[model samples]
Target: MADSASRAVFLLQLTDCHLMPEPGQLFRDIDADSQLRLVVDDVLASGLPVDHLLLTGDLVHHGNAEAYRRLLDILAPLPGKRHWIPGNHDEIGAMRAASAMPCGREEVDLGHWRLLLLDSTSYPDGRGSGSLSETELVWLEQRLAQSTERPVLIALHHNPVATDSDWQDEIMLGNAADFTDLVAAAPQVKAVICGHLHQSQARSIGQARFWCSPSTSVQFKPAQADFLLESGGPDASPGYRWYRLYPDGRVESGMRRLAQVAPDPELG
Candidate 1:
């Protein structure tokens, strides 16, 4: 049986990689592949015994099969049980075909906590906005019901709550109210971790804490009225979130960025 004894489970969240099939291809003027390499290297060097790596989404820029395959190649050496979900920019079919990693699962049991991965991508309309279908909602509720005794950490692609950036808020989860209502009802839920804003943010709503991890490639500027990209300088380095989930239902988390990564000259 999975043990939730005295030890803490180390998990890492890497989001918005935006990598392309080509090695030097740039997304928003940032060399996504290089940045991802740097981020992966940093995580390895950190000496953190990461038990699981939660990839929150936007793994690739164009949703290409080759891109996903390339990403798998790049992250092949990372030591953890890697799981990913789809982002607005990702093609679900391609991602699934390219990797053996499960995309959306009802729950992933980690010793003391249950990690739920949700699909927030809205199809046909093809906008940035997200939605939880009726079926997904039912699935979520069922999972929550079954895992009442375990602390739950939900992972989705888009932020379910407002990030204060008007443009980003518009693109966030369309059914966030419904989503949060379920979360609020489930006392076992400890946190909701996500990506898509490309910037880091943490906020508490009722019992659940919501956290947005910075992108592994380029980051978007926060709290802006309109769409704005982070300046490619010291202020906007690529980063990931580190999570330490304790056996007693407590979570310790923080963001870590590459120390000396310079912003792309063109983006600057």
Candidate 2:
């Protein structure tokens, strides 16, 4: 529930952790566990009251039970309800079994705002692209119809629009037109937040805005023709996004990154 006095809901969005079964494992020259720990530490230390933690997707590097256990252990201390969706790298069944917290919730009510969680990884078998089933689209319409007055924010694992990066765009939501068309028709829809691009991107389609957050472990270079990692520069550090949702249907968001890079023992 949002604080009635402030009329604002504070949310933390953490995505693409890519954690491994072992705490010391590395992905793309970045130590996944160490990076995740750094981000989690900063979020808790900020002393900001968060109402919800929206884990967009890619919770693990490999779809394994042990990896989910490690992820859960790292995020144990964070307060608030956590809602998650599956990415290509996640094993849905394994994640549900490993998590003590709720895993896949389609809709959540936060005061006057409603959050819809969609599973874009319809074919979860190492495929980079994503799609929503017919049933999901129908459910989305029903949900939107039911709450036309409340502001809605949708979360999914894949980008619903082009990132201008040819390689990344190819793997984005396959049925983006269908999805966006539905969103465009809904005046109550405020934002669509997503992951899997591994970089921050923002675009506006009609009245709705789409946002993609950077990964907690590594970030990919944006607007590239091919797959590329972001060079270890000041702007390329692992990070998360914070959102402030107001009662009047306004949303404010920003990204936060650690000043120090996660220690990569393998590089040493």
Worst lDDT 10-window in candidate 1? 259-268
- Indicate which candidate wins on TM-score: 1
Best by lDDT: 1
Q: Each candidate's TM vs. the true structure?
A: 0.92, 0.92
Q: lDDT value for candidate 1? A: 0.83
User: What local lDDT score does residue 243 receive in model 2, on the 0 to 100 scale?
Assistant: 77
After superposition, the stretches of candidate 1 with alpha carbons farther than 4 Å from their true spots are 1-4, 123-125, 260-268
Clash pairs (backbone) in predicted model 2: none
Model 2 per-residue lDDT tens digits across residues 1-268: 5347557888889999988767777787778888888888898887757889989888987657878888877888898788889887878888878876555547998987999999887754345997887888898989989879999999989899997899988899888898999999999999889999888776776798777788898889998999989886865888888777888898877777776423112111
- Cα-based RMSD of the predictions, in order? 5.1, 5.8
**Candidate 2 clash figure, as a count:** 0
| Residue lDDT tens for model 1, 1-268 | 4555768888889999988767787888878988898888998887878889888888987757888998988887788898999988888888988977787654787877889999988642466877878889999999999958989999999888997899888888989899999999998899888989888787864697778788898878999999888886654888988778888888877878897522212111
